[model samples]
Target: MMDAREGRRVAGQRAEGVAARYLQSRGVRILKRNVHSRGGELDLIGMDQEVLVFFEVRYRGSGSLTGGAESIGYHKQQRLLKAAAFYLHRHSLWNHPSRIDVVAIAPGITSQYRVQWIKDAIQASP
Candidate 1:
């Protein structure tokens, strides 16, 4: 049997995959995933026309936003913002319109996981 930690990791990965598929289905062009820099790490990055979106993928076993979206507290938001800035500057996309978004996935027993997309989820200066 897998350990609790491993199980959680697997679940999180599944959630991220779901988030990726969901975004792709919505016609958001994916740019990158798990981008790492000196500032921080960004879970996913995508483009929606002129807007460059930085996404944070989260998973909870409940059907509410409380589990995943709420997990992105203020500090986490700050880090994500900084990370987005780093990514933009590195890729010379600083002039592009950019925003932060959250994709919350909640696993279920008999049904597929639920996903919620929050556009412009965080407001912090780059």
Candidate 2:
């Protein structure tokens, strides 16, 4: 039997996969998934035309109280920004245009999931 943690991990991976496919259909080319840096983990990374996109994937069960996107609070946004910065500095991609995006997954009425893709979901702290 899968443990709770393992189940959650599997669910997250599934959500990311769904999100990636949805983005691809909409013209985003995915470059990476599950990128782990010193600060945090990035669920997906892609390119939308000239802009590099860093994606944060959030999944919520059908019965959960908090919506998937709503769960990414202030601290989570900070961590994601830190991770994005680390990725940019490490890859020497600072000169490229980049933005953070969020893919929120939840149960849908007719389909398996309803995905909400928010562009420039979180801005870097100034």
Candidate 3:
């Protein structure tokens, strides 16, 4: 039997798959998934045309009160910034056009899942 943690992990993976397909349909070429840096884990990384996009995939069940996007608090944003920075520096793409995107997922009435792609969702500190 799967514990709650494991169940959640599986659900998250499913959500990430959905997000990746949705993004690909929109012309995003996914470079990697579940990339972990010293700071944190990046759910998905892709190129949206010339822009390097770092995606954070968030999933919320139908019963959940807080939506997926709402769950990304300030602290989470900071961690994502750090992770994205590490990736950019490591790849020597620090000066390249890049942005953080959020893929918010939830159960849908008409489809399997509803996906919202928020571009330039996280702004780094100056």
lDDT at 48, model 2: 97
Model 3: per-residue Cα lDDT over 78-105, one tens digit each: 9999999999999999899999999999
Q: RMSD to native for every prediction?
A: 2.4, 0.7, 0.7
- Residue 110's C-alpha lDDT in candidate 1? 73
Off by over 4 Å in 1: 63-65, 108-110
Query: What value of lDDT does candidate 3 attain over all alpha carbons?
Result: 0.95
Clashing pairs in 1: none
Candidate 2, poorest ten consecutive residues by summed lDDT: 117-126
Candidate 1 local lDDT, 25-116, one digit each (tens): 99999988778898898878898787999999999875454778888888898898889888888889888899999998887567687788
